[model samples]
Target: MSDHQKTEGDQSATQDSMRPESPEAAAHPRRLKSFVIRSGRKTAGQQAAYDTLWPKLGLDPGTPLRDSRSPGRESAPLVIEVGFGMGQSLAEMALAAPETDFVGIEVHPPGVGSLCLQIQTSEIGNIRIYQHDAVEVFEGCVDDASVDRIQVYFPDPWHKKRHHKRRLIQPEFTAMLAAKLKPGGLLHLATDWEHYAHHMYDVLAAEPTLENLAEDKFVERPEWRPETKFERRGQKLGHGVYDLLFRKR
Candidate 1:
């Protein structure tokens, strides 16, 4: 098996150990998972970076963030991004905003490995990573009302009607995310799928604690977010991208 395949198998084994125990527990409506582990070969450079850089850049998913120090400056605002695929845009944002600290949550091993490489090569100090489920990390590790901003960009559309339940922008998760943000903290989301964009807008709008940042239900993409390769590809295919920004009220 390739290194990536082995890594994915190990992660799945670990997840299995933590699965609900009893048949009743299992039958109690399993949480809708937003991702599937897809194995890809990890490059030697990525593996090396994961080995060397992870000690300094990785965060334990079970550890509470209240005890952790913010990268660079203690007073720096903490920005957390969910599912930062390949970490390209995340690395760019961290580089551009050196005064702000960033926390990225992703489950894919190759993406984690690639981000480790980026952190090492760029000598980036303002970002940390958690290679685990974002929902679990938020609930178990992050302190209430502690985050300054939350970003979710280009999440899986889960386009099929039967798969809509698996989409990440659900109402319960939205409320939980809003509660994690301090009053006035921002939640920013973007998507190339119009259906998913509308879904996100409806979910966020339903959260009474969050106030929309745009006059319209959707907002134009902000200047701070770097144009990602996936986004460029979507544009080339004549896809419309929508951004939504909301603040905790």
Candidate 2:
């Protein structure tokens, strides 16, 4: 079997044992409180949906967070898409690949609500979600060598030169992601900002633990990615979009 297939085989063998206990099982139950405790930050329309749906669809305070069940089909491969704005691409990709499990992390209320709605309306059981900072999620919850793929689509470019420090794709953060991914695992990133793309290439290239999968420039956009309205607007304005794929070495 290829290395990817072998990883899946190992995942199946350990799925059951890796299931986490409910949050109530934690030593301090109150610590299990979700970062999304307040919906007030969301716009009225977003809050309305969140109020109506989160209670029913949201995971109980401490339900085992990751999808690790391998009953009928092997638990679909775990793929995490961060900053999935409004969940357009996330919902489309999950529907396109039912065999792949997905976990989405977003801090924006409207986006979180939209994704939750998609997960519910589509009857997609292969996905789960969390409302917290992506950095904390990687550092605290996700296990080493547990994630198969990590996707970051159009993170805020932090356009101002001084604000570039705030961009999500950085050496330190990429290193953290490398530590989280299984060997040979994939990291797929996209951005419309040319400067940001070059910055990403430089940062990733410097990382000895990862290998760039693309030869010359960024690869052609994958068919599976949904062209968001923002991307469309970018195209109309002459801004180019870049996709970068790297494998953990």
Candidate 3:
């Protein structure tokens, strides 16, 4: 892969390899991670951002957010976005909604650092981050019936049938995600892969509590979600994007 591609994917590698949640989830990771965890060092800007911005913007694994609710900023809509690679769109959303508290969960170190840099450059204060497995963060850190919206955009398709099991939008994981939502809380997902979009729809449709927001089960990309350079590239390549929105019932 090109260095640019290696350092910054369109989406974060937030896939969970292990199916079950355990305390050792962090200790033992990446047996069959859905996306390639590209190996590299953080850029100078990213490293510098880590030094200057991480203390205020970073969140530790298993930090209980339900009780604290972002260090004295309570009563704001709590939005958790999984796999926010490079954080361009996530930062835009945070800037757009100053009244909302956004918590981004990404598994890549470069992504974490890059987003820290975005937070600094954008000068947005409503965003915090967790540089850890998305599944583990959802399982342990976020409390049930607490989140207002959850976003998972363009997770790896795992296109091969044999590797489909590693795809992040499995039944078990969907249920766990739905459990974290408050009643009427929304879950928004988008993907360029057709089959993977359907797979996501099937998994989320099966969840007992989530009601599909669209009558057709897919919706147009909302204005709140900014198109990333990666997504624009995909669009130019004639890729069709599908968005699925569901709300806890």
Candidate 4:
């Protein structure tokens, strides 16, 4: 069956079920969440990739990621990306940085399937995926001080005033993420929403363990990050993009 067909089938089974508890929530018992489940369709090719490739590339949230090596050599730097939509940029980065091991955490199934297809078609070996809440992945699976870099690009802005509580770059979340980073590890964030950018700056600045790398409040977009489709749409709408780089102290 096609990905969309599978999703449609799965939705019927899950639609009446209560939302699954996040690992973080189970650990700490919190109601706040940065993302909501959305229904999305996937192609037949993507579904095929999920059925064939997910077993090899998927990581269970209950299992901790140990041993950074992928079969042959010494451990390489580990980069974890949160909420990689459709896995385009994550795959691009994995292709560009062969020496770096990449782990992506995303809740959406179609995105995971799309990424699996990319890994299969491109023969990319350095990237693995966790189809779970990023908070849960960080709190449960990721080791403390094990990551070299963390990337959060264009996270849901949660634009309404009341919805601001759902923004991902809050002080508490920043501190939690900081704890998982090795000293001197980098946290890179990019957003087209100016208000969210400022919020990120303030929250990150309050964390004693993190230091902003920008000379000013925001830094220029680094060359390594490819322009995503959402970014292009934002550009067309005259929204400014902000990049923030922070190093763990």
Candidate 5:
């Protein structure tokens, strides 16, 4: 193989070696995003899911929503749910708040499939999907100040001290996301990991343009975000849940 290809292969090997050897990792994290596919290639399952659900969700090709406005002369506020695993909360929010349009970004296939199935079964509209890295999608696809709210529930904590760099709730990423939100737009983040919860608080507090909505450091989990199976599993093991809500300055 060429030098570039050889380097890529070596990096893949390193990642495979680093993944946890526990059975839980195998049963759940089938393959890391970096190893499974490039940024945008949908697997057969994802493709089938989209094909089945996109129509029901009203996200057909040529859908006028790419620019963050509703069809016709009226414009609707936009909400984005990043790392929306299986999209349960997203669907609930969409059904509850039909006036707002929702865009969900996720990299996992089964999660996307599950969300699509739900959308089709529910016959819901007013949602879109971008099956890619949320950072790139936020910067490239979404317009400045176009979003009214951003929801990120239970993102991968990257719990290891050394792997902390890979955590999604970083200052740079949040800054980019804040720029996409309108002034006073809300950013909602939740986590079940104690260490990562404090990490999120520290990072968001340091960002100059965002302010915590809660009077205290932490906010109670709202009724809206129903606990998922993964979260329930964590809770059964005594993992505490934390939530942080902030508004753009």
Candidate 6:
């Protein structure tokens, strides 16, 4: 996840001089955007969330994020969820773990608006959002070794063989994700695509700084991740789900 990260790969080749995340990121190889901007219209409720709830929950990626918890919960764990589509599972997770603060990223407006609504109806405070490209959010905003958990649930698979380059779980990016975690911090992923699952496994496995929590190829879905409408739809289609959990070494 730039939290559970997209293109689950990233971007149009970007020029540092234009929208640079930081001087250091620009110094690295030019990056390609993996995910496409999805088009969708928001409901009136969702629009309202953006108008009202956003002021409370929205984040500025240019600003450094520190201690992402409510008052007196200074020691709460920090969790990042990348590509949180529609935000139901993420909002549920926040409710289930009030002791943790969740920072969610999604480039799409509808998803951000949907999540904003969830936060309002649920009346949850520990959840915040960055309605921007997750890549820049991580590179520019989140501090290295600051997060306790990073969860990327079902990023765009970019299923076409030629489009595999657009998949998010690449070597350099996986290495960056590893660097974001505190030692022993957890990285959890879930996908319904079997091919993408293997791809995710191989990329994460190759990261020198990460250790797989499951001895086998996959793990049972953990309790914290509520079953999402998307997952249920996949299930009805006979698609299998795979969960992968790893720890920072």
Candidate number with greatest lDDT: 1
TM-score of each: 0.87, 0.75, 0.85, 0.86, 0.76, 0.85
Deviation in Å, model 4, residue 16 alpha carbon: 18
RMSD, candidate 6, Å: 6.1
Per-residue lDDT for 1-249 in model 5, tens only? 111122334454468568756887646743222112323345576568778766554332233346434566146878888877667878888888877788887656665676787676677677777666676676667778878898888776655565565567888888888888899998889887789889999998898999998888779886766666766777899988889999999
Ten-residue segment with the worst summed lDDT in candidate 1?
1-10
Residue-level lDDT of model 3, residues 1-249, one tens digit each, is: 111342233333224323545769658754533245666667999999988988877787857776546656777899999888778888999999999999987766787788888888878899988877777788778889989999988877766674576677888789888999999999999888899899999999999999999989799998888887777888899988899999999
Error of 6 at 200 (Å): 0.7
Candidate 4 regions with alpha-carbon error over 4 angstroms:
1-30, 67-69
Model 6: per-residue Cα lDDT at residue 176: 80
User: Over the full model, what C-alpha lDDT does candidate 2 score relative to the true structure?
Assistant: 0.70
In candidate 4, the residue pairs with backbone N, CA or C atoms under 3 Å apart (3 or more residues apart, or in different chains) clash, namely: none
Supply candidate 4's per-residue lDDT for 86: 85
Error of 5 at 216 (Å): 2.1
What ranges in model 5 sit over 4 Å off?
1-49, 55-69
Per-residue alpha-carbon lDDT of candidate 2 for residues 112-212, written as tens digits (9 for 90 to 100): 78777777677766666666667777777777888889988877665567445546787888998888888999888888879989999898888898899
lDDT string for model 6 (50-73, tens) is 899887787877788774445786
For lDDT, candidate 3 versus 5, the one ahead is: 3
Worst 10 residues of 2 by lDDT: 1-10
With a 3 Å backbone cut-off (N, CA, C), the pairs that clash in candidate 3 are: none
Greater-lDDT candidate between 2 and 3? 3
For each candidate in the order shown, give its overall lDDT on alpha carbons: 0.82, 0.70, 0.80, 0.80, 0.70, 0.80
Alpha carbon lDDT at 26, candidate 6: 45
* lDDT score at residue 202, model 3, on the 0-100 scale: 94
TM accuracy, model 6: 0.85
Predicted structure 5: clash tally:
0
